[model samples]
Target: MIVPIPPGERTYRAQQAFEFAGSDLAGLVLFDDQLIQYFTGFIFIPTERPIALIITREGERILFVPRLEYEHALETAQVEEVRSYPEFPGEQHPLLFLSEHLQQLGLRRGLIGVDHDGYPPVMGYSGPALSELFAIRRVSAALDRQMALKSEPELSLIRESARWAGHAHRLLQQYTRPGLSESEVEARATREATQAMQAEMGPGFRSHNRWISGAVALYRGQIGPNSALPHAISINAVFKAGDNLVTGASAGVWGYLSELERTMFVGEPTPQQRHYFRHMLELQDLALEHMRPGRACADVDRVVRAYYEREGLLPYWRHHVGHSLGQRIHESPFLDIGEQAVLEPGMVFSIEPGLYVPGLGGFRHSDTVLITSRGAELLTHYPRELEALIIPA
Candidate 1:
């Protein structure tokens, strides 16, 4: 049976990060929304207003937010103090309040480790850098390294996420038809799968996104020739009988996520389509065979690119093999040509090697994988063969 993340997970993260920051620093200040959630388990919408989490070397945790989030922070933030300012760009700016609070916490004369120099300049709000107000050192890479490696509890959530994503993908296939618009099909399938998830997971389960309460599976406009563009935006185009479609599905289990994507067809595929689909599967197989513990991330990309080049399909290669995923959809240690990070046990990756033929369609499959001591463990259980993915015209 799958278990939810332990209640003390956030506290453990905070303690580990503080230990990594060392005693020389006054504290560690996190301005990134994902980092705050990683360290505190307090999920909040990121907007023009900035929120911060401060962890002192003494293990004291403090959270600062706007007055609008004061009650929410008090109830949700895992911190000793939940301080709030009136608003953003108020007479006393939020940063000023943060500075004063830091001083009150005895952080006047020492260096503080920060994820970024200041609150990210998002949504037209700009202000003085944290360096302008206090002494700071950038330690974002250290945090990234810590978050890249997953523990047993984190993997449990991701495993659960993959299970729901597979269920949603099955619904997406069952709901697809030649005459319906992509949005109509997606809406019907997502609603039914979400209802099923709610029934099965019980009331204690909650999605990471405030708007989406359960699993999501979508085509994202990857229909017919539009699928040739790897990142095609959804235009809600209608499905056609002979259309080659690409689809994606994912679900958030308390901020942990898993990716599952596939290339499928609305009806029987042509001979050329079958050839490309088989080649795409072979390329992905080559990459997966090379993915093992202690292997460099770049090696996987290199192997896949070599196969594409040998088959004269390099022009169709649009992106890298895949990327790591967890609290965010995309994370570090990417399977790219230049990444030097070695594959280690506990690192989870989305193994996707895609080929997009212009004016034809895209053929690709993505699955979540975990690096184990012996080899890689596949997490997403969706069928990959073309025969299994075909839909009736």
Candidate 2:
């Protein structure tokens, strides 16, 4: 069962963190979609039009949005005030209205904290820098640290997402065959998984419409030799016997998500395929064992790299071991050589160490895991053994 974060908890925490930091911040003005939604439960389609959420030092919540989203913000945003601009690139420009609003709130001259110096130029948007209008300090790192540590409620939702993603992946394996197209198999598995999820989760459940909607599993073109590319686009080609495939699966529980990926073969895998698959599993196991509270995020990757180096598998290593995940698919405190962030008990991560061999296919399995005081706990529960993943010819 999914647990919802208490309304206003996030904003309250943000306010407290700011107060404790002693940055003398008057308040925070957020422009990033994820940050806005983190502080305010208001979810909207981010477009060229700019949207901002203001949280005063006094904990007063104010929202600025496009006129088209005014009503939606009022109904959903957990803010005391909802303000709207006429449109994007209007004669006055939305930033001007936002400037005036800030002035009216007596924050124009104060060292207000912000996620960005100006609105992001998304979808061909052009605008004046927030610094051009008033004083602002970048405080995005504070939020990043806060988000890296997932609350109990947030973990619950992510766990729920993992549960559904596992169901979808199982369906993916059951429906896949030598003759079927990857697109058709993925669609069929996703449809069944979504229906089952909706029925079981009841009416209060809502789909977070980022990536694939609701519960979904996809190959993303990771079929045959194409699997060698970690981030491949779909080939829209049919599956053939002896082809190795890689799959990614996930389900959105509110805004939280979990990732589950696997490598499977249409027919019996060759001896070489089995050899690489076993090594990949061992690499992942090493990564998971090294991950724990108080360990530097870089340390995890270093250990994984050492294993690859010792086995002469460094040539096949393409990416880092893993990264933290939550409201967004990829978040802060990544497991990379340069990252200095330490793992915390509440952090969630996608632990995947992949190896790609040209002409053979990719051998990779990704699972969502939670860092605990003792070590790490697996949130995604799907079979990872090669035998279980093999499909009948």
Residue runs of model 1 more than 4 Å from their true location after superposition: 1-4, 19-23, 210-213
RMSD of each: 1.6, 1.4
What is the clash count of model 2?
Answer: 0
Model 2 is weakest, by summed lDDT over 10 consecutive residues, at: 14-23
lDDT of 2 by residue, 1-393 (tens): 564567768667656657533469877888989888787788887899999988888778899999999999999887789999999898899999999998899887788888899899899999999888888888887778888888888998899999999999999999998889989999999999999998998888886536547899889999999999999999886999989899999998888899999999988899999999999999999999988899999999999999999999998999999989988899887999999899999999999999999998999999999999999999999999989999998
TM-score of each: 0.96, 0.97
| Candidate 2 lDDT score at position 66 | 94
Model 1 CA lDDT for position 100 = 93
Instruction: Report the number of the highest-TM-score candidate.
Output: 2
| Best candidate according to lDDT | 2
Residues 268-318, candidate 1, lDDT per residue (tens digit)?
999999999999999888988988999999999999999999999999999
